[model samples]
Target: MIHTNTAMKTQYHPISILFHWLVVVLLIAAFVVIELKGQFPKGSEARELTKTIHGFIGQIIFVIMVLRLFARILFGAPEPKNPSQALAMLSKVMHWLLYAILLIAPIFGILYFQYAGKEIHFFGFTWPQLVTPDPVMKKSVENIHELLGNSLYFLIGIHALAALWHHYFLKDDVLTRILPKMKGVRN
Candidate 1:
């Protein structure tokens, strides 16, 4: 049997951690396809292929995010120990902003593609049309989606910097909270 206090101690659920890392992998793949997209000549097979892969991955990321959100709420997360009230509020705001971007960016991409008269298909699976083609709307949504996708690097960098700050300077569990546990070693 476990004591209530011991059980209450903060630790991320294993499944959540797994999903987190999985999302990281997907994010990397998404970035790779997008970054390499322009390398291929315009209207080339490689360019089209990369775009398809990127679209598929983007959609997958959104679906996984939905699952991650559900799991996060269901499993709960380690409560934070903020050094200051301001920092605590900042932390919450940053997190929600990241979540918002993850959810919104893909949606914008889907809408953009549909309006651009591009078929949104994953492998052989087809996504039904959402709206009639509109070059104006497509261009607008494409720009926003692309911008948001690129912004992930900056946002993720800030998140990592904060984790390092906590680990090296504040000497807190902020970073370790999401780190995998080691066997026969101090966690």
Candidate 2:
């Protein structure tokens, strides 16, 4: 078994906490921009601009995820305090699912753009097209990307609810483990 100093550590590393919340904010911005795009007419500049903004946010999220993964490996997470084996297993699976979605969704988004014969202009840089333009492939990839994007809503909802449940009902540090520690205040 992998051993950890669970009693000594009450929270995740500060960097991990930052990365977790940063990704949450970025995801929210990405979803908002895409939805906001609908307010503009199709093919209009405002719509296209919102799409570009969404793409940028996705790219940023992908980069942060890579860094976050490294940070997770370098500074391991604190173990849950006195969790049931089943609950611990469920938490592990949920976390893996969340990580998979965050990483894969962005890749499919990039492929969707490439298959549609469009380059992703992320901030001031352009991402080269990885695949030759193909209308059929574009449609297929777009569907997969959208499906994964939609899945985020359900996964994130369950995650948030689980955290709240642990905090309020179960009265555990499961939620505070990933929350930022305030100065002059205890978690």
Candidate 3:
């Protein structure tokens, strides 16, 4: 007899949850790397290595984001059952902005790398160069990339705070909406 696999009823899609958490972890790691690399003196191989790792992981995030977008479009997601009108609108806007940034930031990063005369390695495969070396262009792209990073941090912070506010102060069903439901809990 063959056993069929069934999806979990209580949890979000395993892959979705995994990707969600992975993105968070990767973002934290990226921030830490960026901070450490900046604070330490430059011109060292360690700094260079850290930068390469950051770029590499960033590329991974780009790919993951693409897959996530596709998954979201194809599979769709359940929205919060009940939320204040303002909170609901904020959620929609924030999600769209998040997607916009996820899609654009990586392209800019890749462009920055190319303009800086660097080849991108994606999991042992090298992506062809997209731009000829130009320090000025590279500098411009780097500045934009940095700006996007800062904006993304603020957006993510707001998202996190909103969730916390719902759980703690608002005392609404907002947090429970997206979270995997507990088996024994009665609504």
Judging by lDDT against the true structure, name the best candidate.
2
RMSD of 2: 2.5
Candidate 3, residues 124-163: lDDT per residue as tens digits?
8998986899999999998998899899999999988887
Candidate 3 is scored at a TM of 0.83
RMSD of 1: 3.3
Model 2: lDDT equals 0.86
Clashing residue pairs found in predicted model 2: none
lDDT of each: 0.83, 0.86, 0.75
Query: TM-score of every model?
Result: 0.90, 0.91, 0.83
Candidate 1 per-residue lDDT, tens place, 7-92, comes to 36587777777777887899999999988999999999999888888889989989888987877777776655578988877877
Candidate number that wins on TM-score, 2 or 3: 2
Strongest candidate by TM-score: 2
Q: List candidate 3 segments past 4 Å from native.
A: 1-12, 80-83, 177-187
Clashes of 3: 0
